[model samples]
Target: MKTYETLVAEALTVVPEILPWDLQSRLEQAPAPLLLDVREPEEYAAMHIPGSLHAPRGILEAAAQWGFEETLPELVRARDSEVVVICRSGRRSALAGRTLVEMGFKQVQSLKMGVRGWNDDGGALEDADGNEVDPELADEYFRARVRPEQMGP
Candidate 1:
């Protein structure tokens, strides 16, 4: 029998090191994974992976929003659909992915280094108001708002 991680990794058809650039291609070829930004709303608004859905970790884990049926249709179309959770780093997303799995989401994965890594790798990011933002400006905003050291487990 496959371990959960093994199963998920295979289902997703990619691994963490393959950062943001391959994302567009992945979406084109396979079932587009539901790109979930699990950071705070403010942090997410400042900049995030393009085409991701906003489901902050707090909201996703909170009992109120789990398996929200209203979003199910969109979820289903994203490659038979899988939810890809992301945060500043891999930690929170890993936890979120685990929770989704428990909730019977058969396929889930965490973006290993979060959007921060994506930005560092020259990935395009959009602003809080859903406008295009210069990468440098987004970096500054994220640096100011995302206190990684202060984040809680």
Candidate 2:
């Protein structure tokens, strides 16, 4: 079986692009790209980049197909729409980015380091209610909840 690093590395190779935290901040301005957070709902609620749309990795394809409330069907319909996929760390987003590209999204990209990287780079994050999420608190939560194996190599 492939290790997580191997899988992520392979996915990254084929993904169209990667948006670093600094670049993502710039994109958050006018004509913002679609920021899709692929973490679970609970994780997203705990903290996420403001304005990001939530669609867990598992249901991403289905959500796109059936048109859920948060589904960006219009954006997805436009093959070249700038869509950025993100997860708790970069691994899952890389895979998700590959999936989007395979699904015909020409401008799909993954957040280079996910939310953790964003926080490390001083990017702002918010809870589901739009309130700012304290960085330290968020870090503590992640440390407590994330298993070492999940972090990969």
Predicted model with the maximum TM-score = 2
Cα displacement (angstroms), candidate 2, residue 54, comes to 0.6
Q: Tell me the tens digit of each residue's lDDT in model 2 across 23-128.
A: 5565758767788899999999989988788888888886565456656575456457778888887789999888888887777778886888788777889998
Q: List runs of model 1 lying over 4 Å from the truth.
A: 1-18, 61-80, 144-153
Give the lowest summed-lDDT range of ten residues in model 1: 63-72
For each candidate, what is the lDDT?
0.65, 0.79
* Per-residue C-alpha lDDT of model 1 across residues 1-56, encoded as one tens digit per residue: 87756654553443233355565466677656788777888878777777888776
Candidate with the greatest lDDT versus the true structure: 2
lDDT of 2 at 36: 85
Clash-forming residue pairs, model 2: none
TM-score for each of the candidates: 0.67, 0.83
